[model samples]
Target: MSVPSQVDLASCADEPIHIPGSIQPHGFLLFLDAAGRIEGWSANAPEILAGQLQLGLAYTTLPLPPACTDLIAECIDLLAEGEYAPAVAAVSIAGHDYDAIVHGSHGRVIAEFESRDVPADTVAMFAVKAHSSIERVRRQRSIEGLLETAVRQVREFTGFDRVMAYVFREDDSGDVVAEARRDDLAPYLGQRYPAGDIPAQARRLYVLNTLRMIADIGYTPVPLLGAPGAAPLDMSFGVLRSVSPIHVEYLQNMGVHASMSVSIVINGRLWGLIACHHMAPKRVPHAIRMAADVLAQVMASTVQSIEARSDAELVEQSAKVRTALVESLLIDEEPLDALARHADDLLAATRSQALVSVHNGKIISHGPIERETAEAIVRAMPADASDILVRDKLGEWPQDVHASVGKWVGLLGLPFDPPGGGWCLLLRTEQIEHVSWGGRPEKLAQVGPLGERLTPRGSFDAWHETVRGHAHPWEATVLANARLTQSELLRASNARRAQLDSTRAQLLAMLGHDLRDPLHSINMAGTLLERGAVQPTLGRRIQSSSNRMQRLIGQVLDMSRIDGGMGLGMVFEPLDLAALVEDVIDESRMAYPSIDYSFANPGPTCVRADGGRLGQVLSNLLSNARHHGEVGRPIVATLAREPGWAVLEVANGGAPIAQDVAASLFNPFKRSSLHNPRNRTGMGLGLYIVAQIVREHQGEIAYRHEHGQVVFTVRLPLAEMERAGPT
Candidate 1:
């Protein structure tokens, strides 16, 4: 047979081994629909059954003995109930006993018949051997010991020339960690196989099927016969499914004629495999293979148990480190400084050479790494990665970055959210490793009897390589500990920020209270000097400065009160909103005599609001217009009545607020720094206080820069017209 070239790795991986539409010569397969009518049959079916087998023929009417048909019928019944699993039975066909394996696949019942080359063992006898093998495997505490016992027991049970336990690594390459073989056979223990040796699709099938066998690698493949235009039968679950030609060639090159593999699966992931090889053509009876499956399962559970215990120890140590670091963060006033104190412990816990924490936009680190290197490492982190990330090699970096990590080859990262958004990183130095492969681990093109095509490498000798620029992989327990630490740091950081905000507000309130008495004394002194007509000009200037100071102090007190959760107290009543607007405009005209002013008064618009708070809102909005408006432009104010509401609009002509500053225009402590700096005054609380007063009245306020003009609008619910009264 001409095998496809392996030059194209993608094509080699795409090879469809599942629907080969054939079976090995030692067994024949028959595909039947739910009604028990034969829809397809292997080309060798007639020869094996000793009678003609036709498509569309009822299986029960076949010339097989009654036992085989009854067994198949029961399997078909199970398929109807959605409980179908592979079942095997011994039955006589044409006076010769055969092993019948039945299962359901692709909406059809698949039956396979393998000629009996050896007598089948009784259930009691197989159970005794299986129990003995499983017990031996379970008694071992370490994974190495368990695998060693498993290979020995499987080799004894199957009588294979060689048996090896192969464990897969994270990269899918595998090592033959344990082996049992005859004295004359060459040892394959500790030999590694490349991931490409078994394509990706083949690994997936191993997980699904779990157990597979090839009685003879040299046997001819018998094709299946089906109706015209019928889709190729899906033999994914077929017991007698044909093996891939390339795989058959691989085994022959290795001098393995017969082979069996049982999967070691744990927690739904393919962990490893138990592979058995024979130098001569050998057929393992169905019962022996089942026993090997049981032994494999026991080995898998024992491995899981050992791993869990190992992880538990690591977790205990990790908990101690995490607890210390978290306590430092919560107890110490400076969290980054606290982390620095425990840098060595943090590094040792994750097996790293360096530790760095990015907090409050500052890099605090205790390691040999430079500040530039730390920044680069943080920038290299994948934005889409979750809270924690692990990297062991430079090859995994994104394309735009350099494929080098200097002296270090691995890193672990934890990203912190804003207040100061940054990352914590741990770096690991490179470790050199020496690896031994079963062969060169490369597929080469060679001319065989059929043609010049890609075939398995001929050499089975060990090949060695020195691997460099990689670090020991990060463990699961380390990541778990990092996640726990990340969660605690976030919580404690939030608590600290809240406490700081509360303290600042309390300080502001205290300063506002303490300065009021001194300011009142200054105002009283200025008033006396003006009444005495002594230095009247100086007295007026002093009074003017004191009035400005008084307003600034009042705004500060109002902001502190709101921030401290004491909301502005208000008494709602009906008043003429137009009158309030006119009074505020009159005051603004006096405050800035040079600026032109205009008012559009919708007379006597009644509104439900606290008259004092509403007057403050009008005053603040007018003051904002006066301060920020263009020197020659007129400040305009208007009041209007809409359905169920009263609308107040204040407009000024000037440069619109920058997009960056406009978003926080009404937020406390914002400044007009980007505007006319000379006009900056009163802690920038004018618009903020106005917005708060409007909200307290259950009104909506909005600001927009449109058509080269900045406008502020307030909408409040209207009161009954009958309640309108003069203020």
Candidate 2:
């Protein structure tokens, strides 16, 4: 005989098995229409019947006696009620006995007959075995446990040498998660089979036909010959249907003489299969196959129940993580800082190796990564990307990202342009998997006349491949949980901003009241002075009120300028600090002659500063001392020059600053910082303005308690002062 064409065998996967027109000759098949007429019959149909089964003839006219007809009619009625109609009826036709099976679907009926006395109690016996197996399957607490028990029970029930729980992964590739086999036979447990092993059409058939059995791999095919004008039969539900030639070759390559598989349907989808294989030719009876189908049904429900519980736990954990991140943000003033606080925790939660967070052009990372890699990732990402970009295999990604990610196998990107720029990317490293395929993966594709062809490998030996740049796939729940985190953080950021806005509004209202009180004092003093009824006290009060108004206006303008990011336009010059202090004190003496002032400077300390701003700082400090100083005690001002620094000290004998109040003493809009009741009415902006000026001049200011007195000191670099020389 000529050699079979390798090309034809390679392309056999695309074969239309549904209309293959032939079936295994183990049983005879008859097709009936909606009216119960014999519309078609297999080539072997005449073997079991008393005579030829005439096409277009009513099935009732057949010589299948009353009891067999009634059993078939009852099965048909049950099928109409959406229940699986039981077959296995006894028929006595023309002095010959036959075991018949009936199935009704889609307004068509198919009945098959075998020349055997199928045990009269086979259905009852199978039911008892099925119930026992289902009870065992139900007792399993996890999907793995359920699959393990299912394979064991199927192996025992079918008497196959090996039975495996073939589960499909997210990529549609399958793996033997659990298995049961004879000790002598080598195990196929945990071996991954490529997705091409089972074609898409075959998966569809598994959904329609839950039970499939092959008595022997080499059985002759029985063809179904339709009459003229008849459509080819749809054998999707055929039990003894002829197997796909490619699949047959595949089994033969694996040293299997017979095989059977039952579909595990979960949530109306084909989840996996309970595959049974025998090394020697074996014939599994219909009764055993029926028992296996029931076991699969129970297994499907058990798997779904276990998954539901696992999903519930995952959701609970995700909620807890989100709550913690939100609570962290609630107390934090900066949104980015809050997100950074949970960076490590969030990275661990996603089960990734690393995470990167970008906020307003600043980047924070939780794992070991190079700056170039981070910039590469940011470059590849879309600016307005709102959806999570998840990749399972980094090697499969576009070259731009693939090269950048390096050994990282997976990534979950949450990119968003928040004003300027903000995004987050989580990464996972490759898990080098040494997968064991059933056959030599290299031989599966051979160099034929054409470049490459899909061919069954000759050796069913263990094959190894070092899978690189690919991680275990991310679950849907993981992506969803991360998405939820991004959304929660965004909401938290908005809430924090709103809180700040409310605080600003309250500050504005307070400023309105504070400004009005000072304005009213000036207005009353000016009116009294205009009427020539102003005493010395009234005249001094008017001057003090006017000075207070000018100070408040300057504080507001300085705040606006600082917020606008405008640096102080300093006219730096050599200034005599001792002389400046004397002038400020003389002015203060005129304003508050009741309070004594003393001044001292070791030398003429000349320094560089914005003279106007520096003088404003000194004036504010002296004013504060005057208001909060001990009554009848002299306020002392001293300037001293030290190595590379100029020090200014203003000390007053009064209550020291409270620790809590001192902490925010220079923060804008902080509450009153004075000990006197009258001084508490001023806007809390003078110290803030002074602090800003000091920072702009690159100087340091601090408060200290010395000998029951509150001492404020200023320290500025004296490098330039030394260059200018002592005055």
Candidate 3:
């Protein structure tokens, strides 16, 4: 046959140019001019020209019959106009029909040919067949629908007992989604077959061969070539003949005696299969099989279209759901409730049963399921886990109430930690039908707990039979894409955490280094002054500086500890509250002699507390009052014992903290205002430390503005102190 220009004939010029073997046995070539007139013919042209023309006649120059002549002319015109590529068609020569092809190159028809010696009826039939195929393709609603139709048509036309469009599952399993069968045959429309049934080696062969047939499972194989240097003989059933006998046996076990499969390739990979099976041994002519193969090609395109559309829809839906969830989390403040309300809809959209769990390492709040049951699930999952579809059964749940519940068939966990110290668990349950493998017959008889009466054999008998014809349901590409998205989100979250940690470390280092230098200088000056080693005025100034430095250093350390998540140890004791307040007052007066201080203590008051930390709390409050309040105003220090705790109040006539500032006052390094730049000397950790210390003592600390005065109070639990007895 004459090759198309696009076929790169030059590449094969040096080699013996033999025709590519095809199921269609007859081959012919005809050369045509740009104007559609035949120019020349190959030496084999007579095979096609025999019955239609006389010997030595120039068929190329002769006017063709109207039936095929117009069709050829139209093809030539389209090719010259660059509308058609090298394409196949059918034409009439004399009273006979011949399948023909025209090859175009350099804006001209280079070659054309038609089969010879065909009957007139076959020629007319061929033309009608070619037109029908083209029309069917052009009228398809969608690629998937088109492919489905194509497979059905092939099965009907080829008289295959059972034909199916089998697609690969994400886990490599195969499923039959579309099927056509004889009236007496049962359908396998949705049936799923295990990956092992196909085997890696078998799958590779299917993809490589593109089309294969086991004409007769019991047929004695005919070996095309013998072993190297071996004598030629009837080598049927030899290992080298064709398909392995082992595979044939496997097919027979599945009740299929004869089978033909064509690989559906998408994006250069084996996407699935178009499979035809027969229960009885059958023989199909080569031409008929070639026609079926062409139909399969059309089906492949349809499959691609369907897959693309489905993917687009999935992506759009996922985007919407993910956006809603994330927005509610960052913007709504109450994300948990929002998620709970929308949980059902979200689960349905994803075709999953979702569970959300909130955990703080020790405490957990499970969604939907019982807390104990949820906790058990969490414990079963590993931290360095990946998403999976669990098919094996989980025998029993940890909680007794759920003892009779069927084992968990499938689970997917996605962990997320919110802004605070809690984790959000996104879990999905696998569909029962999928997990049970549609209830295979061989494994159904196995007994388990909940009594033998409830064995899989009995429980799933109806379901097993019902789902036998159902295809496996899974979209591997979709899940893979989702996993990639989740991984990216996790990576970003980890990166942000690392950045925050680095910033915190740098800030702590800066604070410690900056504060230590001043503290050392002040301490040295204080020692000299206390020893009378400086002038009286200098000594007084040195003492004040030393006290200020000590306060700064304490604030730095306290802030550091809190930020570092260090827990506090409380040495609780029943102490005389009155005496403690009096001592705090005496110390404050001694340090700020110019500042007036008043102490009011309920007589013989007693409570429990860590004395040193409490003293530090009192000192920080008093110092704050002296530094920020009216400098010379009297600072009131009051102590009293209520039913369950001791209360200490430190008040001064200072500018009251703003509402916003008061809310965050206990936060480290959070100051009231930046109005007084000169007084910004403190690191803003005093009150924060005070709150920490009081909390360690099992106390509460708070501040409120009252009558132009700011009052800070510390209330400690009395029973805690009493239990400790002494520090």
Which candidate leads in lDDT? 1
User: What would the TM-scores of all predictions be?
Assistant: 0.63, 0.68, 0.45
lDDT, candidate 1, 403-502, per-residue tens? 4346566878876444555466788877787888999988878886435766777888999989887888887778887788777767777776676586
Q: List lDDT for all candidates, in order.
A: 0.76, 0.74, 0.55
Better of 1 and 3 by lDDT: 1
Instruction: Give the number of the best model, judged by TM-score.
Output: 2
CA displacement after TM-score superposition, residue 531 of candidate 1 (Å): 24
| Candidate 3 residue pairs in backbone clash | 48-116, 97-123, 143-302, 190-469, 190-470, 190-471, 191-470, 221-236, 608-721
Query: Model 1: which residue pairs collide?
Result: none
TM-score of 1: 0.63
Report the Cα lDDT for residue 332, model 1.
47
In model 2, the runs with Cα more than 4 Å from the true position are 1-14, 46-52, 65-67, 74-99, 114-130, 343-349, 367-380, 396-404, 415-417, 440-455, 498-727
> What is candidate 3's lDDT per residue for 1-727, written digit by digit as tens?
3221212223322121121111112334444445654433333444435343332334344555554455566667677565344445456654555555444544334333433454546545554554465357546767556656666766755667888887776667777767888878655676676565565656665654466666667755321211222222211111112455445655665577778777777776677787889998764533355556566665667667776777877777767766665544432222343355456655554555445444334333333555665666656555554443232233322344234222333344444443423333444443345432322544332334322322222221112433221222335654654565345434444554565476467557756666676667677777887797855666556665666667666665656555445534567776776787789898777866888899866776666667787787888888778777875678888877677777789999978787667656765455343224535566556666777787667578888888888899888766654444568
Q: Write down the worst ten-residue block by lDDT for model 1.
A: 1-10
Query: Candidate 3: deviation at residue 308, Å?
Result: 3.6
Query: What lDDT is reached at residue 369 by model 1?
Result: 79
